[model samples]
Target: MKGKNKHNKLKPIMKKSMLAALSLGIALPVAGSLPHALAGAIEPTINISRPVLNDDIYWLSHSSEQVDALPIMPSMPIGVDNNTIIIDLSTHFSSDRFTQLGAISENTNVARAYVTNDNKLVVVPYRSGKINIQLQAKNALSPEGEMIRDNIELYISKKGDLNGDDKVDSADAVQLYNYLRNMVTRRGFSYVEKNQADVDRNGEPELADMNALLSGYANQSLGAKDNSYVLTFKQVDDAPYALNGKLNGDLKVGATLTSNIEFFDPDGDTPRSMLYQWYRGSEASGEGKTEIIGATEAVYKITAAEQEKYLFLQVTPQSYSSDRPQGNPVVLRSESTVAVKQEDIVSLSPSNGSTEVKTNAPLVITYNRPVKINMNSFSSIIIRNLTSNQIEANYIFFLGNNFRANDNKVIIDNPGLKYGANYSIEVSNDAIIAADPDDNAYMQGTVVEQNGVQWTFTTQIPQ
Candidate 1:
């Protein structure tokens, strides 16, 4: 059979027998008796041939006598330095003869496989590392099946070693910085080089890497091309740093809650990003707390309802560097703020100790009065699989319709619960809760010790 792609040309498909050879994991001669040779005469012979690349495409082919042989392997290793290699089907057989093409990479994150319009296989590398790629071709001819196959290696460069000088010192750091700043122009680096220069490995070469390099120098620990950036410490919590600011104070009903929870890094490295979340709860112990809607600023106002309520702050500081890879951003979280007097939970969904709850039911908590929430504090509310002791829900903080400030209600979304499973929703002291800003009695409540709340129920069995 023949087929046409964007190139508008006929392509032959490989016989089914060839694809079968691939599944068997070893190349052997196609099923057929060898031609009888004349007495004392040498018999004609053929071997499986390896695929070749032309014009960035890969090509494959095999002789009739070579049907059982495996596809030829690449002559050399391939890597991020030389990732784009091709294998064109038209080279070994007519495009019309092959129907399916398959390719596999040992490490998907490091390399990818692509087929071109003209039926050529293309291998692309994404990072500075080594990966293996394999290719296979199949056709409908002969239900017995036959396949053509090939394999190749790929390699990406070390992170931060843009010049390939085998070192990640001030020279590489300066070069990367200048490149990002467009100070000069030259062309020894390839796609893999920029990836290597991305010291922070955040998919871009940025100033965070420079600052990390500088900090590393100060600590006498700058070095290496490993996937994870090496640092004297992975997070600020281990560093000799301080958290400063107006973390705790009293406020009048009409005044703003003073905010000043700041993280001080002793090495003075700039953070790639910083996050702040304020929480309010009924007790000074921070139980029954919820995130304050849009309270992400370094400071928050003390609304009327928050007048007498206790408040605390939470801050997350992050920094990026060659030592701190993208997926593993260096982060340090501050302890929860001092729990302050807050609002109360007047009603809870599933009625606390209720049983036979629906699997898809939502968890709801209603306050006695209008209340505000601290979004990040939702982490303190854990939904665990009582039988497995596994927490099944991942709380995503969003101030959508799920939360109604006017009604003083907060709804916790559950991803999914198992049928007939016993589950527990435990609210810890860290969850935030606060009264509405319009209330005049906000400051009238005495500071209370709201320990926390926990409820359990069994889900109905699935039909």
Candidate 2:
């Protein structure tokens, strides 16, 4: 697969020109969209149908009164003949498939399918390895039916030709090999749909299929081609903490694939002898591709194609040493065909907020994405003081990444203050940061304030 480059592109004017056509007395998904078919070389075909926001099931695309996901598929596939991109999920197997990627925020849904613009099939690979969200959540989008539709945005790449034949092959055994290569668990394909190369046809992949993976050019001689190769280490504790983080791998495609790289500080708890290496596999049982880099430039580039490949990190489990073989491999996987140039940190909350707030209610801040913060990684200061600006105190609370937010409310470990007392909580100017090696720049520390004022809902104590 020849490497393909992707940059964010936008479309809007078409909907305006077709305003008359849109108002044909019908309810529609994003009626504002106009038919746009571009006949450019290797352009991705987009199936855009903004759903009826409040009424339809979130996952289904709706016309005025009904939800229709299929109909929502890109209207144009490939060319000038009312055809810009053509999709044949049936040709590949008749089974329909779609993908989504919202690495920046679990709350944000970024889905993608093979929608077309003209006659040519558009292979759109999403470039948002991560979105600009905060490490904390603030008023995360509603999780009703809209969420399902949002999931549809998961994107695939133009270069996912696993067979090396320059096409997505259903019958070819390479898709099987690629799938196996991407597996980080024994329960292969457990989370995804079935593939043609189930080998044993048990609906689950096994070592037999793994061998098929090897047979499909399993391990090959290493060379320059491997340079673009990279491994990833994602801290998936199910909780975003480092000790519980998992390491995975993927092929580096561009500067945008930094999520796959991490600093495996051997004794990471201590910074010296820091190792920045390309990691691979799951944390439970995998290995690394190279020695850890002991440099300060947190991110390093892996000059390779953005292909669907696998990688891992190698760590000496405390149970084992160089002289002793006591540990097992910890294996993890990447967001298939997805890589990051920098850790995907969307953004912090309160990008631009009012300088002051009501003293009665404590200020609540949140992020578009999650963050991994630690004792030293934090960039700002958070403290409390008497509203008159006299008493000052540092709760000295360390908020690591992984805070969750919804309904415009974020959870702070310690509101760390006396209720009804005047306090001004300030987020450091640069308080935003990534804590875990796997965390991106999506978190921002906030400054909240409080006052002695009591709520009307609360009864006042007798003075």
Candidate 3:
């Protein structure tokens, strides 16, 4: 009764005194008068002792594979503030005496808060953001019980603290650089680590971010405030330009011409595509030029229609990533105008069937345009005596002694002829070959026949 009688005698009296104080609008100190066991049931004032209530908390959001858990907490010195906060209770309530001890974060997505079994408040940050947490303690102070509450703000930031040492220093810079270059064993960066490494806040970790971190670290060492270092970047772009351009093939009909053009870009971008246009002009100066129809490739074949016309190639470089997609067009003309595809015999000396022929005159064949006589085929020329029914001269007789080629004519030294002889000159179809001077396009000579008869002439009778 001594143990039970004391508490039993004060229960009704204390309840009536609390009711009387409440009716008279006067506060009563019931906790002082109650028994220790009864006072322990009152709600205790919740206080966050480690981190000041008005001071904001900072935490590193970097995740590491080497660590045991994600969002690895920084290793702080003895006095440094950290994510863990000590929960303190009033004198009336002990740690285990509270009915309930819990914590809730206002923004659970950014951060979360929980109270450990030993009344330690721990904050787990997910990303870079701010969150407010309310710490609560409940006990049976009245019929419905009373709730004690306190709030603490948490600032979760990347801050380039990659090593989880709570400092953005050179060590963090090296780690971030190695991670970006894949020099680390773990090649990939976690979401939180990426946020931490992206010092410029451009949504991705890159070389620029690493450089920014270095600058930030240097500024921090110089007594600059936290997050005072900022970096801004701009993309550089330049247009492509032609270095040198020219036509690579012969400037004549029936020949293939190639465009030899080189292009360069100041911004180091390659040409995504190129446009080629082959033009025909009257002069080698590239004036009065007209694009050849259907000639759009890097190579163009000269046709018969382009004979005697100069050719020019215009190349336009194009790039998709350049600030100027289309570069200046480079126009290069062929060295010379196109020449005739084949040479044609325009005139014959001493007429086709002359009745009077001078014995000292040279036999000549002239062409309409300049031509290259195939010295290799010179042995095919032949002259026969039709009247005497015998060979007058053979190719062997006139190999180098009587054959001479001028600009557009082939001259043969006059062969000794008998007086009053009906002589005929027979040149084989391919004996006199005519070739273009520019591109070497050749054509065999046609048989010289006058009214169903070979080239026959009557030499003057001996005087």
Candidate 4:
């Protein structure tokens, strides 16, 4: 293919060769080993030498908790940093990323989701069985994780209009029941009913469904005029700041994660406008003033805005009112410790568990503790394959640390990876800040355990 992109979203076909064997019983045709029937499918044996698989003992915090181990929920507004209301969705479905025909996903963000000030939920949607759902947050976790458990009870479902009364009802069972009789809930083709109908589907709108509808419908506030729709909140910190001044404010990212206020105007039938702004403040000498204003559509970076995370003080997308409240400020700092030492691996592209690396994605390097060095020199990052312990000309890119106003992290693109092979990502941090080339700012970092990072992921063709 002369001018075609050799990396045109390679979709490897695991050619069948023989039965595979695995301790976990996953038989790879060539690589993995499991004892099973021989359809004779051969997978490209990675022979990766098992790069430290303590699972939780290896890499990123989220991976350790196995957050992305399951499907996600859909029907959520990606961003929401408003001050007043944090929308709840536990009244309906059990999860966000659903493996169904009607599943939805956002182009940005995922796993552990956030609500942009504009009132849209950005999340990574996954699928299982015959349904698909969005992972309402950036990462997924099992029920045992302490952090994930605290918020497990949050998030109510948004698809319970059973009575056809333009409102959720107690008898939606009848609807599902009737649908099961003739109408299909899978939203599948004519034959889809044979595959997706709830002959034994997991909890298909059962008593659980009835109860959720009953509770939500029973609530009086829901009946009030001006129905409340989901709104998104976003970080708006790109406005110019003086040298060594604050960008937004002291924004905390834990249990009390906060977003500035932004409201949307209500249209017909819709209650409450989603338009508002947060209180803006200055950390200058005795500078204590705040105001309401519009919010940005997404998170913006303050590359030159000194070392402080700013939070929305007050939101006034709506008309001003004394009763209206303000949001908290956010002071940005590296929350996670950079455990990875040296440029151990940058995975120019999809090497380990990462799935969305682009040829132009920002160069995101993880470390054991927070890094305070400068990375302004190295022209870019590179992805290379390991054939006989030698670095091969697999792929390369120049993803220096160029902060974008609207991005939280940088993605490096086309660090060329081999089809069905393991590779190491190399990031010359010193090059990132090597002003004169000699002073490469290579900081001493730590290695996150295997569980800390997603070391593997499957790829799909660009549909």
> Model 4, poorest ten-residue lDDT window?
50-59
On a 0 to 1 TM-score scale, where does candidate 2 land against the true structure?
0.20
- Candidates ranked, most accurate by lDDT first: 3, 1, 2, 4
TM-score of each: 0.25, 0.20, 0.31, 0.17
Candidate 3, superposed: residue stretches over 4 Å from native? 1-181, 185-240, 243-262, 267-277, 281-304, 307-312, 316-347, 352-362, 366-402, 406-409, 412-463
Tens digit per residue, CA lDDT, model 1, 89-170: 4544345655567777778775577666666666654444456666556644424234544444443443444555445555
Instruction: Estimate every model's Cα lDDT from 0 to 1.
Output: 0.45, 0.28, 0.52, 0.27
In model 2, where is the ten-residue run with the lowest total lDDT?
Answer: 224-233
TM-score, cand. 3 vs. native: 0.31
Residue 275 error, candidate 1, Å: 27
Cα lDDT tens digits, model 2, 244-344, are 22433233432222323222211112222222344433332333333324422224333322233344333222221222222232323344433433323
2 or 4, which is superior by TM-score?
2
* lDDT per residue as tens, model 3, 1-463: 0000000010112223323323332222232231111101111211111211111111211111111122333311111134333333222134543557778988987566787776555554544455667756664433334454444455454355565544455566556655665523344433435445666655455556555655554445211234221111111344555545667766555466877655554333557668888899887787688988889898887776788888888888877642467777777778887877553567677666897776655677787756554656544556666678888776542355666667778776677776777766655543544355444433335353333445567777767
Tell me how many clashing residue pairs each candidate has.
Answer: 70, 105, 0, 166
Best by lDDT: 3
